[model samples]
Target: MIIYKEIEISIHNSIYVATKGLNYYLDKEVRVIIGNQQESDYVDVIKYIIDYIVENKPIVSKNQNIGYYSWLLQFRLEDINYYDLYEVKTDGTEFIKGCDTAISIIREQSEICSYYKLHPQFPSFNQMVVISKGVYEGKDIEAIRYESPEHMSGWWLITDDYDDDIKSLMTVHFHHVAFNRPDILKYLALPFGYRFLIDNNVIHVSKDDI
Candidate 1:
């Protein structure tokens, strides 16, 4: 009955076997039903997204907007074969969402044109969204939708759209998270979308509750 930041539950026989530590349970043979709200996913992806989360890794969207706003990127991360919405600035040559630990930048093209011609931040250029599945080297990777679409779609339009084709980098700062994130998700979805459950206090959850 020790207090844990997160709990890993295997729902095979309603046994609900409780386990501690994110990494320990992730590699185990369990379905992984994390119930710590925000702490669960955090602990789960720490090894893949935080400790090893590097920016500006060259990712090519095999095709444009394949399905539900995700691309088939050539991301070179093996852990990403699962779910995780990561928003990387297409231009690795510059700072994305103000992140600094960028290793190598792909600088994927310059045309990130989008349909933001109405908002105050209209005439924007470039785009970044939570990627689902993508191929690394020669495979398929999926971008996770941590929250509902309505909750996360807003960040898809906050790109630098001032520069022309020659210089698509918008001079105006269009970063969504300038003050959040120990994880790369802060750059992809709205603050409320990803951080909603981080501070939640759900003591227990039942099938009817879901």
Candidate 2:
């Protein structure tokens, strides 16, 4: 599924407009244009594009026609009182083909930021643990307990309720961490309140909060 970030719409003229954003999944720019002489209201157009994006979640290819179903837009515009508008047109030079199966639009900050931030070469770490297990390498492991300076309690525990997709994503995320930040993994089995600082080829841990 493609997630678009920082999507914005702009008007070129009374009958020409476009929407643009970065496709988070592919790390590529995406733009879609619309043309209709009778449709000049930006608000209506913006709403239509928003609904289209949320429902279709389009993904794009380098060599593909960027055409969305005209009938779908027509059906949607009817609700906004599109009584005098012409038949929608998105083809040839008017369209910028390449969107498919884009499931969401993430504006501004995101859950984990850029996909490149998750790249193995980067110096980063997961801010929080979403899932944890009670055993590691067939040995029962005690939970690591830590409290932030803000007084929020944190710990890890075994969970089996995550769906398949979540499990797969988590597996990939951990593998990425393991590849570049193996040091973090070694400390994963460490005892409670073991805060560790990670830098390039550096490791520091504090036994007490300071």
Candidate 3:
């Protein structure tokens, strides 16, 4: 059995929650930037988040940049603006050489480590509502790209038509999709304002009509 411990570290006025035992699992460590040094009460939250990620082994995609992968957390935590995650190299103790977000220690490019970054905005789910469904057949899963104000924009999976209410739609957060219908989670990282059609649980890219 593998066991891991989450530890708190401060560097350059930033507070990070990192793992001590994950190296055994992924040959690297996972570090999360909760907030600046002054933030508090994130230990338990970090522990829970890391545990969930390790246990579920959710889908991870490469970031637009090299040496990084998108490891997004499904649920939102209080006072945490960024839920996005990434992994980088480390000496197993210090931040990667020369880069001092102070996040990790640089190893050969092949080694893996984890970290987090901020997106322009995370879907607030408050102003988000599923506008329609049954837009696609055989899929039973209608996918909608949410285009709204900051913190309220991202992809929306419309599995059913729910009278267009925010409360009901909000319940369809990442967890639901990641758990019950993870086949569509691959589209989570797609850019905003792009609609996709699913046929028999398979995704195909189609040209947008001008």
The candidate that achieves the highest TM-score relative to the unseen native structure = 3
**Per-residue alpha-carbon lDDT of candidate 3 for residues 134-194, written as tens digits (9 for 90 to 100):** 3222245656555555434456666555457666554334333433443443444444545
lDDT of each: 0.24, 0.32, 0.38
lDDT of 3 at 113: 14
The number of clashing residue pairs in each candidate reads 12, 9, 11
Worst 10 residues of 1 by lDDT: 103-112
User: Which is the leading candidate under lDDT?
Assistant: 3
Please give the distance, in angstroms, between residue 170's alpha carbon in candidate 1 and its true position after superposition. 18
Query: Can you write out model 1's per-residue Cα lDDT over 129-202, one digit (the tens) per residue?
Result: 33211111112221222323332333322112212343432222222222122122222322222211211222
TM-score of 1: 0.18
Predicted structure 2: clash tally = 9
The local lDDT score (0 to 100) that residue 97 gets in candidate 2 is 21
Off by over 4 Å in 2: 1-6, 13-15, 25-36, 39-49, 62-210
Rank order by TM-score, top first? 3, 2, 1
lDDT of 2: 0.32
Which regions in candidate 1 have their CA more than 4 angstroms from the true location?
1-20, 28-210
